[model samples]
Target: MRRILAIGGGGFTTEKEPSLVDAYIHRLIDKPRPRICFVATPSGDNRAQIDKFYEAYGSLDCEVSNLPFFNGWGPNVIPYTDFKPHLLSQDAIFVGGGHLRSALAVWREWGLDVAMKEAWNRGVLLAGMSAGAMCWFETALGGPFEQGNYGVQRGLGLLPGACAAHYHNAHVSERRVNLLAEMHRGLIPSTLAIDDFAAVLFEDQQLVKTVSWASTSTAYRVRQQNGCVEEAPLTAVPLQESLIV
Candidate 1:
């Protein structure tokens, strides 16, 4: 089945120590030594972020590699001509977070978008945090645009509706408010709002469950109702206890 784990926040890049969430992602692959590839396009293939991935996964039982889109960093990047086959061979592809709009543009230009779609269809576990999470849905909240305005942004539409990441983060608390407003205004359809350290899992385009590594982390389903915004929490299971693969 096609699967996706869309994380709102918190991952190897955000934490110094490895998290249960990362381990949970590894378990989902069902391979004794899963071949997991990091897609760091959103972070412009930031070397620091890539290093964090290695730090977290290198000692694990799985095999780890990364596909870099940006050039000049010079880190054993797979050639552009080999991207399709290389991505398809992996058991999972984890995208890193960064500038969403710019990432999608570069992805489209490189035709990485098409390769990802194929990977998803082939049942490769597609997962990521923040921008990586939002890219799989139909629409996502794009923000701080021109005078700090937030609005709807297009996605690859692998799944329906919209997505909002960091919904409860104090640093970007406005995300929750703006997301509700957009849904209330009918500017975007029902959306999934995910907090830091929380993630919503999708199987074959249907949300199967929510899970989190942090106690306060959670997910929400928000939509317009009776001319007002309404939201309901999506119950999350603790990833430390169960392997929901």
Candidate 2:
């Protein structure tokens, strides 16, 4: 099945070893020493983030690599000529967080969006946190609007509905409010809001479950019913329990 694991937050970026969310991601890949590639385009291919990715996955059982767009092609960077083939060869692809509008524009300009779609169709696992999580849905909240206004941002449409990442995270209180208001005003369709340390799993474009390393973190289904916006929490299975045997 084509699978996408959209994480609202928490992973190597915030946690250390014994990270339940990262472990769950690794388990989803069925290969022995799975080929996992990290795409940090959203972060403008930030070197620090790239370093963090390597540091985190370097000791793991899988073979690790990354796709860098900002840095010119080199011995380490995958050349544009092999981009599609290289992506398709991987068992899983992880995208990093950054400016959604800028990231999406770059993806389209480089045709990486198409390549990603092809990769998903070929059964490669597509996953990421925050901006990465928001990239797969038809619509997402959080945009490059004026004065940090939260607006409806279109995504790759790999999954249905809208999404709000870091939902209820105290740092992004504005996002929480805007998403609900947008739905209440019928400005956007029903949305899936994911809190830090939690994630929503989709297989064949259908939400299979929500999982979290943080036991208290969960996903929410937000929608407008008769002018009232409602937030319904989806019980999150502990990541450890959701892992495949």
Candidate 3:
């Protein structure tokens, strides 16, 4: 079954304790030393994102490669092979988070979206944090921070309904609330809000698991009840809760 392990936030580039979430993602591939690829196209293939990816994945018992789409990509993605083949070669690919609108625009232009869907069908786990996570859902909330308003953005619809990242963040909690309110107003049917360090996992098309890098993290299922927003805490199992395999 195709799977998506969408992380809300928290990782090498975002926080100090990034290892837990990254390590958990590797285990989900369930292979003895899998080949993991980093897709940094979202962040304009930023060097720092790639650097931190290696910094975290380097010590793990797996082979790591990167797909850089900006500024003359490195040998891993360009001058080495074609697009679809590169995506299919790995056991998993982790997308770096950045501007969602810009990322999707670039991906579609290069047909990486089509390639990723193919890779997902081939059982390569599609995973990411923030914008990376939100894009997989049918709809997502995107905000103009300066204006303090958010609106729904269409996603690839690999998963249904709307999705929210950084649910409990200090600076961004208002955005999350805005999305929930929109859901209540019937602008969106339902929404899934994931706190930093938490992830909601989908196996095939069914949501089967919620895991967190930190115990404090929580996942929420949000919807409209009567004329108001309704929210319930999802049971998110911490990554340290048990042995993955």
Greater TM-score among 1 and 2 belongs to 1
lDDT of 3 by residue, 1-245 (tens): 79998888887778766467787877788888788888876688888788778778777776877876675444444422376787788899888888888878777887888888888989999999988898888886655532334656777788888888888888766767667656666776678988898998899978999988676798899888888788899998878873455
Per-residue error for 232 in candidate 3, Å, reads 1.4
Q: What is each predicted model's overall lDDT from 0 to 1?
A: 0.85, 0.83, 0.79
Q: What stretches of model 3 exceed 4 Å from their correct place? A: 73-75, 79-81, 145-149
Model 1 lDDT tens row, 68-172:
878424344667667899889889999989988888898898899899999999989999999999999999775653323565778999999889899899887
User: How many clashes show up per model?
Assistant: 0, 0, 0
TM-score for each predicted model, relative to the true structure? 0.94, 0.93, 0.91
> Considering only N, C-alpha and C atoms within 3 Å, which residue pairs clash in candidate 2?
none
Tens digit per residue, CA lDDT, model 2, 47-127: 777777776766667677888878643225677556989999999999988877788888898899999999999999999
Model 2 residue 9 CA deviation in Å: 0.7
Q: Is 2 or 3 the stronger prediction by lDDT? A: 2
Query: Candidate 2: worst 10 consecutive residues by lDDT?
Result: 142-151
